[model samples]
Each structure stands twice: as structure tokens, then as C-alpha cells.
Target: MPANHRYSARTAFLLLACTVLASCGGMGGSSINPVNWVTPYKIDVIQGNFVSKEQVEQLKAGMTRDQVKATLGTPLMASLFHADRWDYVFTLKRQGVEPQSYKYTVFFKNDQLERFEGDAMPSETEFIAKLGKRRKLGDVPVLEATEAQLKAAEKPKSATASAAVPASVPAGAPPASYPPLESAKQ
Candidate 1:
């Protein structure tokens, strides 16, 4: 190629690259950028022990470590350095709602719980309400069959068929006798 032609080609390539880079840099902080309008889906993140108010209420001044564990579940953090202290930490991160975190610490003396303190835990029902999404529910349809529907479903049985079957067992009634689960050996 001619020297002038080669120089023009290099300049054109550099200009194109600069234009592309400049456009991208402008989008970095622009509100009109696609990234600003459309966000990738983020899953809820829940971690560590979740102790409810009811469980905390069960704790007493001299409860054993085993009892405390049974009532409030295992602690999230228990270090050898803090052998007598049990720490329960819970965190929840949801997309639209604000993040939630709670920490509770239990101090023990002579292998028994001496005292406990931390953030006030929500009740089970309150926590469940917080987790549910806000939406309007439609009216529920009636599920039970009417008397006319039940009568229409019933069919008259022939006398011979009725005789063949001794009697109809009532609904939910246990069988007169249950056959042995295993076959008898000859």
C-alpha cells in the first residue's frame, strides 16, 4: 500500500477505537445506561442462627448449656477463647427490603447460663410476616359438595352385589383385622 494510504488507515482505526471507548466511559455513570434501568436478579441471602422471641423466653438464669442449645438451637459463633460465651448471629439480605441482622450473646458460669443479652428477636409469626411479599389474594372458592351434589353422586347397587360384599365399612374406620405383614412359613 502507499505510505499516505497506510497512514490514513491507522488514523481511521485509532479514531474508531477512541469513539467506542468514549461512549462506554460516558455510560459508566449515566442514568440512561441499560445497567441503571435493568438490574440482574439477586437471590435472598440468609445465614447463621435465627433465634425467635419464644426461644429466648425459654432461657433461664441457670439453664445448662445443653438446655440452652435445645431451646435456641446451636450458636453461630463459639470460640475456644470464649468457651463460656455463645453468640447467635443472623443476617438476611433481600432485594427490595432493607437488610436485617440480629446478634445475641449468652454468658455461662460453671457450665450453666449466667445471663444473656442481645437485639430483641422477632416472634415466629412476626418474622414470617416480614418474609412474605405484599400481594392481594383473590376470594377463595367453596370446596365442599352441596347436599344435591352428594345425592346425585350416590348410585343404587344391585341386591346380588350388595350380598357379595358383607357390609360397607364406615369412612376412616379401622379394618376388623389386618393380615400378617409377612407370609407364614410352611
Candidate 2:
């Protein structure tokens, strides 16, 4: 064989080997990469509920199982062997953002909340900020209504309900009056 032919064959074999290797890297659903410049889009890897500080604060010793469940939704794990223990776990992984994980366990005594142990939880506001959602807090006054004001608030301001609410008033402002839907049939 000519030297040129042998060299060309060797070069072609190397190219094929490199291409095969490059494609094989991700064959097993693996994420390993040798050279990855462009950021490969990775969907946010959210696994569990993002338990907020408020939820943790709501937990208190002596709270009933029902109350605890109400405060912090259903637990992630409830072992049959450990019937009195409940576990709450949350994890988040977003592109460009640091990963976060939380593990909380609540122990029950006689079906009542005994105590809870876990990492420090963040408040809802803080969690939202961590998720990169920044928004200006509404500059709204918190009024301490008098007895008369409270009474008046119960009455619907307008005879007809209006969706166009004033910026000052929060949405879902209760109607002024709520007559019985169906009066007791005499």
C-alpha cells in the first residue's frame, strides 16, 4: 500500500473514533461532558414542596396531627414503622441559581404534634426573592379600623358588585351585606 493511502486511512479511523466517542458520552442518559461551552438548557429540578419559614413557624409543640397537616401540607414520607413521624422534604435546582434542599421531620406523640426538626426555613418573601422574582412591595396603609368602620365595611359599598376595585382597596374586598341565600321557608 502507498504511504499516502495508509495515512489517509489512519486519519479517517481517528475521525470516526472521535465522532463515536462524542456521541457515546450521552448514551446512558449521562450529563458528563468534555467540552460544553454553550449552556445546555436544564429544566428546573424541583422535587418537593418549598416549605417556607412561615410554615415552619406555624409548627408548635402539642399541635394536633390535623393542624400540622393543615399548616404544612402532607408530608413527603410517612414510614409505616414510624407511624408517628412525618418527613417533609423540598429541593430546587435551577439553571444559574444555586441548588437548595430542605429536610424537615415532625414527630407526633399520641397523634399530636410533638416536635419538628430540620434546616432553617425561609419566609415566603425570601423564597420568592431566592427564585429571582423581584417586585416592589405595594405601599399600602395598614389601617386600624374603628368599630363604626368595621360595621360599615360589612355593608356592600355599591348595590352591584364591581370588579374595578380602587388601587387603595385590596382585591376580594367582601361585599357590604350578605343576605341569606335562601330564607327559611315559612
Candidate 2, 88-176: lDDT as tens digits: 99998887767889998999999888879999988888887778653346777867898888997897667355546655677878877
* TM-score of model 1 vs. true structure: 0.58
Off by over 4 Å in 2: 1-35, 133-186
> On residues 3-45, what C-alpha lDDT tens digit does candidate 1 reach at each position?
9999999999999988976786687778765457778888989
Question: What lDDT, from 0 to 1, does candidate 1 have?
Answer: 0.90
Give TM-scores for every candidate, taking all chains together and pairing residue i with residue i.
0.58, 0.52
Model 2 Cα shift for residue 177 (angstroms)? 46
User: Over the full model, what C-alpha lDDT does candidate 2 score relative to the true structure?
Assistant: 0.83
